[model samples]
Target: MSEKNRDGKRSARERLAAERAKQNRAEKRRRGLIVGAAVVGVLGLAAVIGVIAAGTGGDDGEASGPVVAPSGAQGEDSLAIPVGEESARSTLTIWEDFRCPACKSFEQAYSPVIHELTDAGQLKVEYHLATIIDGNMGGTGSANAANAAACAQDAGKFVPYHDVLFENQPAETDDAYAQDATLFELAGKVEGLDTQAFRECVEEGTHDGWVEKSNEAFRSGGFSGTPTVLLDGTNIYQDRSMTPAKLKQLVEEANQ
Candidate 1:
């Protein structure tokens, strides 16, 4: 080959080698990113577990009294009131306060889709009650209402009674829920929920300690505020673009 042709061929070979090296470096970077991401995910999950364990382990001794979790409550420390089929493929965890207007708004906006998804056996909800409003607004309404809901859970009418509470939710400052009568009257809206046992449970605040404990869990979990909603462990409510329709789509995709 001529000298010129030799140089051209050598340049072509050099270009090919450079391209291969670049590709190799890119692959290595991609692999590193994936491994780093996996480590971060694992650490995040471990942190969540640690928070939950610490919150409910009762080491703080803040929520005084017996931790009387409601019957049928599930999950860590029996703090979750589960709604929907257990076999559902996806789980939506909600941390809410009965006295929270934002929580009421959340229920109004998403309960329909939630009900539809639960009814279709595509999703299950683990409701975690919080009493942040009581502390923030200075009243026991949050705790009282949550106890009543737990009583309703005992009667197997929690869903309807829960909706009833939100539908009849009083103003943030009213503290109307502080009265056992108000809770009972609301429970009356749900058939079979206003039984004598439920009445006594609400009147006596049967699950007050449990509600307090759950609220402690919420506080210690590093959550921002009420209606902290999570879909399959992701904080979906924090996503400003989220909507009921989008939630439905996500649940459906997860099922698929």
Candidate 2:
């Protein structure tokens, strides 16, 4: 073959190789774009789902059940049922969920000492009702119980009814207090709390809105859980090792 012909063939082969390389690179770029676009789409979808789940913004699921907040409810102070004279020097503020076992335990252990102090006009307690259990467990037990307690309060039977409710608290999973019948039955245990006025309040859920208000107040106070006890604005639960006796001692110390 002639040298010119050989040179032309070599140039042609080189051109072909270059063209193939360019095509492969173009194909790689196209594939990269497709894969990157798919990844970005998935990430965006996941971000939306996360925002929805994290309670940032979502569809509002309103309940049709009758609810009414207590009149003049402002904060934890307003939600309290006073156990002693308004002029008492020391105050005990307790935030409790009716369905919470820990609250029942606290009540059982401390009721005697607390009652003694309150009856002596040495201390007053302001009870704050929260419904966190209902929010987590998907039931109306906490709300119903708190509402009924409020009715008992309306009838001037807050202390007795509150004690009895905790005494007969249903298991966390049982959620028996959601039933109006159960609440009425429990009311019967507290003398004078089973009246017609109390019945209407419980049946109509007159204080259901109050239950929600109390919970909101709890959250607004930057609290994350229940049975938060405060004495003279001091958190009593800061010491995990404290006992009922210690609590009483704290109250006594505050009184002085």
Candidate 3:
């Protein structure tokens, strides 16, 4: 071979070897990124599992802890009171924590069905805001929010305030999002609520006892989690996974 041709062949071989090395490095980087991503995903999953397990106290399903409730509180006389219409034959009572994420999930999943049923006069929903998991799940803010909800109930704005509470749920902490100003703001969201009365009730914590009493009643009734739904007074603990179709079927069965 001529010297120039031999030089060109050598250069080509060098370029090919350089290309191979670059490809190897790129492959290593890709594998490292994938491995790093998998590790992060696993760590995140473990953290979430830890939080859930801590929240549920290890989930032994045994009520070994002391039952928390306010003293000398009687259950509400109209705990199952129909709110939609008198002709509504069935009642769907839900005991839920305002700060509980699972409760929020239930609301997102099942509230549309509730609206439809209420509109059709087939169902009336009575919400009993329970604060059993407030301190543990969120904080004092959860209890305060629950108190605010009860106050709204006093002004007959429970449903509207309920929606607002869920809408503004403290994603980081379970603090009351509807502060005094927000409470009045949410009152405006409801048609008939007297904003002044709602302000007074929330300020004085007038509904605090009621929320406590509801929590007590839920504990007495043997509920272990938030969003414990009652379809015509029968406890439906499966609210988390309950779909609209399944709820409709359950409601029909309850009616029968």
Candidate 4:
């Protein structure tokens, strides 16, 4: 072959190689973009699902049945404990696990009534945190969060923290209940909590004993599931569907 023809052929080969390399780089960039988009979509979907699950009540899945006060309850008035009448008649104690989804549902469902009652002095609700669901879902049960909540309670910030945790419950997965740095981060979002004190308590498991004792008493009282509500220490109702009307009815019936 002529020298000029050989040079032209070599140039053509080099140009082809360069073109192929450019195409390969473009393809790689496209693939990376696709993967990144998929990841973002999945994360966004997860956030949506978590929000819906947290907000929605799980009545169908709850272990407790429909709301029905015990028979022969002497009209709903029996349930009303007069507001601020604390002569052994003002307190309605509840034992619940933070990790228990049912407990979350119960809180969402009945918290309004409890709040109204508390505000009106018709009821004084004492919530005893339990950790019974910790081991059940392959995550840290309610113990860690409960302990932190108790610490917040000591700081007069329990209800706010409680609402935030319930509102931000992790999805039900292997790590759903794992207490970690994120929990402390969540606690920090609660207004008025001393972040340092809350973190210290969570790390040391300060309220572990309180949770333990509450669980022991709950078990002794025959509560196999979370969110067991008691009227004046008596096991009168055990339903996940304890709505405001039902709670009010029970309260009125009990007070009579």
Candidate 5:
């Protein structure tokens, strides 16, 4: 072989080796990132579990608020009140924090229309209670409100109490539900909801664990905030342009 030809071959071999080294490093970085993300995801899940466990296993004395799972809930982590026909064509899953002002606003703006659809058997609503504000604002009001709502459910009055609670939701920062008589007082607005049993359920903080679990489910649902409304698994408020008429239209489209 000629000297120039030999040199050219050697240069080509070097370039090939360099390219292989680059590819190897890139592959390693990609795998490292994946592992890092896995670890982060695991940690995030653990944190959620811890929060949920706080409701059932942690020291009751240390609990920031009341904690008890509601009886007859759909599951340990969910309390569903069907607001329409059993075989309704559409299901609206609502994840809401009672102390969230935005949720209250959404209720005030769209609840009337929601009622119309549900009453007509065009839609069913599955309400999921969450306590994002309690976690964020460091209080027990959200949990209390959720628990009271669940207690009302126990009395077969979930729908009415649900309406009344949102109708009376305090400012996000008010934490008004934490006050001693507030939850029961809200119940008074819902006929037949304020009674000895209902008062015990509210005062004793019956269903707090369910509230925590529901909030945990909300966190696990991969949603961004409270008042997360989903229509057949599609997020309806991703753009946040909310109106009762628009909601009715969405349900009609879904039904069609």
Candidate 6:
């Protein structure tokens, strides 16, 4: 081939390579935009849910009562309902909404591992309750159920009652937990949790202020959504690869 022809072939190959590189960069940018948009969508949804919660402002525009912390409640502002021994080497902080289906799913998937670790005195779980569902879906079930759980705490039946709540959690759109009778009925499942004092606590929304305050913490805390499981201050639930075995390994490794 002539020198000119060879030069032209070289130019053509270089142009093709440049075009391919440009297309690859565009593809990368497209993927980045997609991921970024998804994150923004979640944050935006959370903001909208927070707005709904603020608008509801308790049973009727805010729970009109004193902020009563439940028995043995810990953490800042007494918002954390703790489980397991205080001396556990690892602390798992969980912020959840009773009406949230995602929260229930997390509970179902990880509760056994959690129970095992807690039972072995290897981990402590600090449960922070939120009422975002009430704010988003328009009902007091979240607050009511949270208060009932607090009442259970007072009776030393928090763990079991907490499990029962999630086990029987109604659809996100259903306000079944809003009814005292339903909460009372569930309480019956746990021995010695259905006393008159428990009844009054649940009926009176004794911890409504506490639940509301905890939710405010969630909104202001910049969390993405429910089941914000932080193991030793790390947001493990957000990790796509997190699993029960992985959590167990982390806790065991931490103890070592």
Task: State every prediction's TM-score relative to the real structure.
Answer: 0.76, 0.74, 0.62, 0.59, 0.70, 0.77
Evaluated against the true structure, the overall lDDT of model 4 is: 0.64
lDDT of 6 at 204: 81
- Weakest ten-residue segment in model 1 by summed lDDT: 54-63
List, residue by residue over 1-256, the lDDT tens digit for candidate 3. Answer: 8999999999999999999999999999999999999999999999999888776652343323332322222236433323576567788888777778888888887788888888777787777766665546445566567767766666666677788778766663635553666556666777877567667766877656555555556767777778788777776666456577887877666556
lDDT of 6 by residue, 124-227 (tens): 99999988888788888998999999999999999999999999999999999999999999999999999999999998888888887788888889999897
Model 2: lDDT of residue 193: 78
Instruction: Give me the runs in candidate 4 sitting further than 4 Å from their true place.
Output: 1-88, 174-177, 233-236, 239-242, 249-256
Residue clash pairs of candidate 5: 68-208, 68-209
Off by over 4 Å in 5: 1-72, 75-77, 240-242
Candidate 1: tens digits of C-alpha lDDT, residues 89-178: 899999999999999999999999999999999999999999888876777899899989998888888899999999999999999999
Rank candidates, TM-score, best first: 6, 1, 2, 5, 3, 4
User: CA shift at 6, candidate 4, in angstroms?
Assistant: 97
lDDT of 5 by residue, 1-256 (tens): 9999999999999999999999999999999999999999999999999888864453343434544555555534345645677678889988888888889888888888888999999998888888888877878898888888888888889888988888888877898998759887888888898999988887787776667657766777789998898888888878557567787888898788
Best of the candidates, TM-score = 6
Query: What lDDT does candidate 5 reach at residue 18?
Result: 100
Residue 118, candidate 2: Cα error in Å is: 0.5
Candidate 1 stretches with Cα past 4 Å from truth are 1-60
Q: Which lDDT values do the candidates have, in the order given? A: 0.91, 0.81, 0.68, 0.64, 0.80, 0.92
For each of the candidates, give the backbone clash count.
Answer: 0, 2, 0, 18, 2, 3
Q: How many clashing pairs in candidate 6?
A: 3
User: What tens digits encode model 2's per-residue C-alpha lDDT throughout 1-256?
Assistant: 9999999999999999999999999999999999999999999999999866754221133324434544433333466656786777888888999999989988998889889888987788888898888867768799789999888877878889999999999899889999999999989998877988888998888887667666667767887577898888988766677777886776677678
For this target, which candidate reaches the highest lDDT against the unseen true structure? 6
Error of 5 at 252 (Å): 2.1
lDDT of residue 67 for candidate 4: 27
